[model samples]
Each structure stands twice: as structure tokens, then as C-alpha cells.
Target: MHICHVNLASGFSGGERQTLTLIKQQLAMGYQLTVVANPKSPFADEIRALEQCQLVLCKHYTRSHQRSITADCDVVHVHEGRAIYWALLQRLIHGVPYIVTRRIDNPLKRKWLSQLAYTRASTLVGLSSEIVRQITLRHPQANVATIPSSPVQYPVSNTDVDAIKAQFANKFLVIQAANMYAHKGFDVTIGAAKELEKHSPQVHICLLGDGKARAELEKQAQGLGNISFMGKQSAMGNWFAAADLLVHPSYSEGLGSVILEAMATGLPAVGTKAGGIPDIINHETNGYLIPSGDQGEITYAQISVNPLIPASTICSK
Candidate 1:
């Protein structure tokens, strides 16, 4: 079987990483694979060296020119938002059916083209049940399936973990790993850190990721010593292994796979009820879920996560 994966993201992020993982697994399973991505994007660089996977550069989804590959494909899999129209066009012109994996819970525009593209797809997969619900709400006839993104469980040496722990010694590490985007709700973290600094001097918030919003978020955290932003780090597993808690207060989320990664490291999470965070977090059992963009709730949640406490009981609703 042949599978053509399309991911036209401008930069590398969680969704692109998931797409890359899927392509590698499918190729290993003896499925011929082709990937459509931005030539300059980090995702393209990662996929470029993969054996048996044909990397087709589609800088812009609309201007894509891959009719020959579409003709030979057994299945067309769209992995991002802009690629939906590209796959729809291929299905219309070449008669190749495509399935879309919608990675976001943001509602689709109520337009004819958006409706047509979704309804025409062979299947629409959501990273979580919440995303599935959002898809159905946009188009009731939309065929949707829920398949959560898998965690990588990145390998890390004990030395790296110990080093990270030593860097933040004597502090209850509250970590957040996500692109510093506005929708990621960095404001909530800043607010929570500001409040926590007043009472819980031992609690420290460490954000690990960088984006256009970094400067703005830094300004918001002005005069705060309890919070620190370390640009993007390659040693995610080391941080998770060292951290006491992971707080993801995203205003909008697809599946919150970072939460899953933290859990894989035996680190608990305090995520917002937004999007598919509720899918993985069991509310006081595994982790906690609070209102999206609630600064006070985040502050309270961080204070509750005692570093001395074992990984067994982490957070609550």
C-alpha cells in the first residue's frame, strides 16, 4: 500500500512531529510513503533524510504541483489545516480519496469551501474526542475518528536529569513545554508565577520553548524571579524527569500530547479543561484539570504540587 502524507506547517511543532512519527512507522511497515511539506520548514529537514520516504516540497498548499504522485497514491492523508484544500483538489482532479487528520479543536469557518472539503474527505481523524466533537459541530455529516497522538518517551541520561535538577536545586520545579504562542496561554503562567512568588518562594516555573510571543511574555513576567524562560531545548526528557509538575494552560489545544510525555516520565500535569486535555488527565487521579486562562487556579495548582510528594499523587481538578 502507498500513503501520501501532507503536512504544510511553516515551522516544526507537535503536529509535525506526530506526522513524522507516523511516516516513519508506515515506511517501516513496508508502505510506500510520500510527504508534502514546506521545503524550508524544520519538518522537511527531518523527513528529507528518511529512507524510502519521498519528500515532495509544497511550499504553499494552494500552489502545490504533485499530480503525478497523487495519481500513484493509494491513500492521501492530510495532516494540517491548509493541506485540507490541497487534498480536496487532488481528490477532485485525480480521483484519489483523502482522509484528513484535524489536529486542532478550533472550529472551522462556516463557509461553503470548508464544508465541501471536510464532507468530501473519506475520513476525518481527530487527535482527541474533543477535537472530534468540534469537527462534528462544524459539519454534522463529517466522518470523524478519535486517535490520540502518541508520546515519544525520549531517552535521557541520568547525568542530564541530575544536571537539570541541580540547575533548579531547592525549588519545586513547575515546568511547561510548548511553543510560546499566544493561544498557549503564557499569560496564565506569568500570572500564576507572579502570585506564587508572593507565598510559595520555593516554587519555580520553568517554560521550555520559544516563539514570537516570547518577548511579550517576558515583559509580562517583569520583576519576577520565580519564573524563567529557557529557549527551546533538545533535552525534553531530562527536564520532565527532573521536574515536579507540568502545567499546560492552553486556551486552545488539540490533544495535549506534552501532558502524555510528562506522564511517561512519571511526572504529573495540571492542564486546562480546554480541548483534549481532559482525555488524558483523570482529574485528581492522574493529574488535574482547571479552567482555561485561570491565573489564580494555576497559582493554586502549583502550590499544591509539593516536590517532596511522590509522583503518585500530583494534582486535582
Candidate 2:
């Protein structure tokens, strides 16, 4: 089957990474694939690099040009939220069928335009059960499916891991890899880190990824020697290998892909009981699940010291 994937996001994030994975796997299976993305986005650059895939650059993916780009494809797969509207337009203009993948747990607006988009989709895929429930509640007649995001795996040499460990010697490393968004709850993480410092001076918190809230979060974490901001690092596996635990205090999430990545590295996580975190983390078994923005203290003693599994074992399942 010929599938055309549509994603209009300019920045590279979890959704874009998932789209790239799907394109690569489908092409390897002897399926014809095409990707419609912004001309200037990193996603388009990666798609252009693939030999068997076709790349179509649409700056806005406007309605007038949708038919020309997707007319020959058997299925239109929308990977991002903005592309849903474009798919709806194509379905109306050229009688094309399209499916949407919803990646966020945010509630859909109850407006007529949003409702029409959901109701008209051939299929709606949610990354987690919570997202599926929200979509079905908003539009009862909408066709929805649940398909989780794939786990991310990367190689980390023992030399690299040892180097990182030496850099943060005599410290219990705790890492959180997420953008500095309010919904991500970085403030809550800082608060917990501050309290933990008062008791366990050996505990160190590393904040990964960059966002608009970086400066503000840095200021909030000021005068706290235990907390450090490392900005965005391309090689995340090295950091995961160096860390003892992962803390994801997100207020909202469709599914926590970072948590899965941590699990794949045999690192236990301490995430909030929000969205799909509970689905991946078995509380007290694999990791700990705390309430969102809870003022209660979390110490190194609360974190699990046992390794879950090797990277290959977790990824294979």
C-alpha cells in the first residue's frame, strides 16, 4: 500500500521522531511511502535522506495544494494536530481517506470545527488510553484506536558512561529530559530537588532539553548546588547511562516516551501519576509514581536501586 504521512511541525520533537520511525519501517517492508512536511523543517531533511521514500515540501499544506500532493496515495496518515485540519480539507475536496494520530492528552476544543475534524477522520489513533478516552468523550461517533509510540534505543559505550560517572562523582544522579514547558512541570521538579538537597546533599538533579522557560527555571533553581541545567544534548543515552534514576513530573502527557527510553537503559523512573505514565511504570515494581506537583518530599531512599532490564530486553518487548 502507498501511504502519505503529513506533519507540518517546524521543530523536531517526539512526534517528529515517531513519524521518521514509521516511514523507515514501512519502506523496509516494501511499501510505497511519501512524507509531506515543511520545506525548512528538520523532518523534511531526514525524509529527504531516505533512499526509498518520496518527500513533498508544503510550507503550509494549504487546501488548494493538498490534492496534488496526496491524490495518488492509498492512505493519508496525519502525524500532528495541525495536519488534521489539512486532512479534513483533502477528504472534502478530493474524497481521500485519512487517519489521525493524537499525541497529546490535552482536551479537544468543543467548537464545531474541531468536532468536524474528529468526526470526519477515517480513524483516530491515540498514543495512550487516556487520550483515546478524551477523544471518544468529545466525539462519541468518532472512530478511534490506541497505538503507543515506539521505544527509543541508542548505544552508549562503557567508556562514555564511566566518563560521565567520574564527572559527577560522589553524587546520586537524577535526570529529567523534557522541554521547559509549564505543562511539563519543571517547577515541581525544582521544588522537589530543593527539598531533597536539605537532607541528601549527595543527590544531584540534571535538567535536560531547552525551552522558553529555561531562564525562569534556572532562576528558580538558583543557589541550589544540587541542581544543574545541561540544555539540549543530542546524545541522550550517555546521560541515561550516567544517571541512577529518572524523574518526570509532567502535569500532562499523552505517553511518556522518555520514560520508556529510560527503562530501555535499565534506569528506574519516578514520574507523576499523570496521563499514560502509570501504563509504562508499575509502581513499586519498576519505578515510583508520585502525584503531580505534590509538596511531599522525595528522597533517594524512595527511588528503586534495582535495574529493570537491559536495553535489548526492554526494546524487544
Candidate 3:
């Protein structure tokens, strides 16, 4: 089958990573794969690296649709919101079958229009059961499929892992690998770090990834010397391996891909008990989930800083 995937966002994030993983997996399985994206995007470069794949440079087609995109492929698998408009347009204009993957927790709040837009799609794939439930609750008759965004086949280099491990050797490092967003609770993670310092001076918090909320998060971390903002880095597997634990205190999440990535590296996870996290993270098994918002700080800090719990226990589950 000829499958084409499209997303407009430039930088690499969870959704972008998911797109790359799906495309690579499909290509390995002998499917004809092509990506419709910006030539300058990391997605474009990654897709082009695949010998079996083809890429079409259609940068600004996100807001509206073009007949050419849907005409050539048998199946159009769309990821991210920008591609959703294209998916619906294809169905209305070209009679092409398409599937969308909803990877984020907060579905747009505009109910009627959002419902209409989603119901019009051929099939909607939710990255977590909570997302599927939310969609069904909104449009009772809407068709939504549940599929966990599987862990990436993370490449681990021993040299890289050792280097990062040495950088934060003495500190009991707590890392949060999430985009810099309000919903991601980077502020909350920093708050927890500051609160933890009152009782435990040895604990340290590292915020990973970059986003619009960087300035605000940095401002919040100002007085908190234990909290360090590392910004965005392409190499994360080694950091995941080096960190004492991973904490995801999002107000909402589709599946918390970082949680699985941390678990795969034998690192424990501490996240808010919301969305798809419950489906994968067993309380006191691989990780701990706390209530959303302010209450999460206390719960997350305690779980993350605990010395009794070993990171190795996370991978076993």
C-alpha cells in the first residue's frame, strides 16, 4: 500500500517523532512511503535518509489543501493539527481514505466545530484510551481507534551515555523531557524542585526541550538554584539513561511518550495521573501518577526524590 504522512511543524517533538517512527516502520515492512512536508524540516531530512521513501516539498499547503497531495497516494495518514485540514479537504475533494492520529491530551475546546471536523474524518486514532473516551464523549457516534504511541527504537551509544552521566555525577538528577508549554507543567516541575530544596538539598531538576513558555519557565527557575533549564537537545537517550528519574506533570497528555522512553532506559517515571499515563504506568510499579495541577508538585517531588526506589524497577514492568 502507498501511504503518505503529513505534518507542518518544523522542529522535532513527540508528534514529529511518531511520524518518523511510523514512516520508518512502514518502509521496513515494504510499503511505498512518501512524506509531504517542508524541505527544511527535520522530518524531511529524516524521511529522505530512507532509501525506499520519497518526499514531496509542499511547505505552505497546511492552511488549505491541494488536489495533488491526495491524488497520488492510496492512503494518507495525517499527524498534527495542520495536516487535519488537508485530510478533510482530501476526503471532500478527492475521495481519498485517510486516518488521523490525535497525539495530544487537550482536544480543542471549541465543541461544535471540533466535533464536526473530527466526525468528517474516515477514522480517528487516539494515542491514549482517555483521548478516545474524550472524543466519544463529545461525539457519541464518531469513530475513534485507540493505539499507544510505541516507544521509539532509541539508539544508545555507550560513550554518549557515559559523558552525560559524568556531567551530573554527584547530583540526584530529576529530568523532565517535555516541550516548553503551560500544559506540560514545566513551571510546576520547577516549583517542585524549589519546594524539594527546603527539605532535601541534594535534589536537582533539569527541564529539557524548548517551547514558547521558555522565558516564563526560566523566570520561575531564577531563585531556584537546583533547577536547570537545558533547552532542546537532539540526543536524549543518554540523558534518559543518566538521569535518576523522569517526571511528566502535564495537565493532560495523549500517552506520555517520554514515560515509555524513560522506562525503556530503566528509569522510573513520576507523572500526573491523567490521560493515557494510567493505561501504561502502573502506580508503584514502573512509575507514580499524581493528581493534576498544584497537588501534583508534592506528589511528584516526593516520588522523584525517593532514595528507596531504584530506576531499574521501571523497565521490568
Candidate 4:
């Protein structure tokens, strides 16, 4: 079967990573694949690298709606919120069935366009129950599917892991990997790092990923010795292998894919009790979950990471 995947995100993050993972598996199953992406999206490069895959470049917003996108595909899979417009356009113009996977738990707008998009899709896939709840609460008649995103085992390089280990030597590295948005709780992580400085000096917080919020977040971290910002990284597998622990203190979240990625590397996480994090983190087992935006609780979770959970990971689950 031929599948057309649409992800019009400007930057590559958890959702984009999930899209690539799905495409990789489908390719192995001998399915024909076509990816519709932004011209400047970093995600496009990964699709181009895959053999037997067709890459279609489309501008963000309205321009993503093209006849060629859904012309020859069996089904259109929309990966991001903005791509919903493109999928609906194709369905309207070509009579193709489309599926939308909602990655964020943010409430759907009551506006006509959003209602129309949500209502018109053949299937609405939510990465977490919370995401599903949001849509069903709005468009009660919409067909929603509770399909959680799975984690991929990244190819780890010993050399890459060694380099990260060498840089943060002798320090208990607790990394938080995600796009630097205000709601991501970067500030809370920084605050926790500061609170740890007086007591657990060996514990360090490394904020990974980048975005427009980086500059301001960096300013907030100024003069803080226990925290450092590692801008947008490509080798996530390597960093996960080298880190001692992972923390995701988002004020809000969908499923917290970063926790799954870290778990794949046998690295346990201390994610806040928000969104779908509860789905991944089994308290005192693979990892721990604290109240969101609670600096004191965040610090406690980091300092109290079990020494034995590393032997088993949630990757299998």
C-alpha cells in the first residue's frame, strides 16, 4: 500500500522523530512512502536519505495543500497540527481518506476551521489519552483512536558517548531533552539546578534542544554553575547513553517522548506528573514522576534516582 506522510513543522522534535520512526518501519515492510514536509524542515533530510521514498516539498500553511500530495497515496497521515489543513484540502479536492495524529494535549480550538478539520478526518489518533480526551471533549462525534507513540532504539556510537562523558566528567549529569519552549519548564529545571547547587553540588542539569525561547532561557541560566544548555543536538542516542539521568519537568506535555528515548538507552527519567508522562514513568520502577513545575520536587527526584533501575529499562514496555 502507498502511504503519504505529512509533517509541516519548521523544526524537528519528538513528533518529527516519531514520524521518521513510523516511516522507517513501513519501508522495511515494503510499503511505498511519500513524505510531505516543509522546504526548510530538518525532517526532510532524513526522508531523503531513505531509499524508495518520495520527498515532496511544500511551504508552511496553505501552500502545503497540493494535488500531487494525495493524488496517488492510499491514505494520508498527518503528523502535526498545521499539516491538518493540507490533509483536509487534499480530501476535499481529491476525495482521499486522511488520518490526523494529534501530538499535543493543548485543547482544540472551537473555531470552524479546526472543528472542520477534526470532524473531516477519517481517524484522529492521539499520542496519549489526554490528547484524545481534548478532541473528544470538543468534537464529540469525531472518530478518535488511542494510539500511543512508541520509542525507537537509537544506534549508539561508543565514541560519541565517550565524548559527552569526558566533557561532563565526575558530574552527575541529568539531561532534559526537548524544544526550548516556555511551557517546557526550562525555567523550572534551571530553578531546580540552582536549588541543588547548595546541597547536591555533584548534580548538574543539562538542558538540551533549541528554539526561539533559547536566548531568554539562557539568560535565566546565567551565572548558574550547576546548569548548562546544550543547543539542538542530532545524536540523541549518544547523549542518552552517556547521561546518568533524564528529567522532563514540563508544565504541560502530551506523552513525553524524550523519556521513552532515554529509557531506550537504559537511562531512567524524572518526569513531571503531567500529560502522558504517567503512561511512561512507573514511579520507583523505571523512573520517578514529581509534580510539574515543583522545583523542590524536581530536585528531590534527581537526587533520589535509584541506583538499580538502570539494569532494566522501559524500552521493552
Each candidate structure's TM-score, on Cα atoms with residue i matched to residue i, is: 0.92, 0.91, 0.88, 0.91
Q: 183-250, model 1: which lDDT tens digit per residue?
A: 99889999988877776788888989999999999999989999999989877888988998999999
Q: Lowest-scoring 10 consecutive residues by lDDT in candidate 4?
A: 308-317
For model 1 the TM-score comes to 0.92
- Name the candidate, 2 or 4, with the larger lDDT value: 4
Give the per-residue lDDT digits (tens) of candidate 2, residues 183-301.
Answer: 89889878877766675566788899899999999999999998899898778889989998888988989899999989988988888888988888888898888888873534432
lDDT, ranked from best to worst: 1, 4, 2, 3
Off by over 4 Å in 3: 62-72, 109-116, 295-305, 308-317
Clashes of each: 0, 0, 0, 0
Q: Residues 1-317, candidate 4: write the lDDT tens digits.
A: 99999998987778888999999999999999999888788899888888578998988657756677667899999985788888888888889898999988999887898888888999999988888898889978888888888896678899989998999888888898889898899888888878778767777778888888999988988898988888888788888989999989998899998888888778888888898888888988888888887888877777666342343421221
Error (Å) of candidate 1 at residue 234 is: 3.0
- The deviation in Å at residue 75 for candidate 2 is 0.9
lDDT comparing candidate 4 with the true structure:
0.84
User: Best-fitting candidate, measured by lDDT?
Assistant: 1
> Where in model 4 is the C-alpha error above 4 Å?
60-69, 306-317
**lDDT for each residue of candidate 3 in 1-317, tens digit (9 for 90 to 100):** 88878877776678889888888788788888767777667877787787577777766644436666556788788885767766666677777777878887765456564555577877888888898887777667867889898788677788998887677777778888888888888777877777666756666777888889999888877888787888887788778877887888888888999898889888888888888889888987777877777643544445445674455422211
Residue pairs with backbone overlap in model 2: none
Model 1 regions more than 4 Å off: 64-66, 308-317
CA RMSD per model (angstroms): 2.9, 5.5, 4.3, 4.6
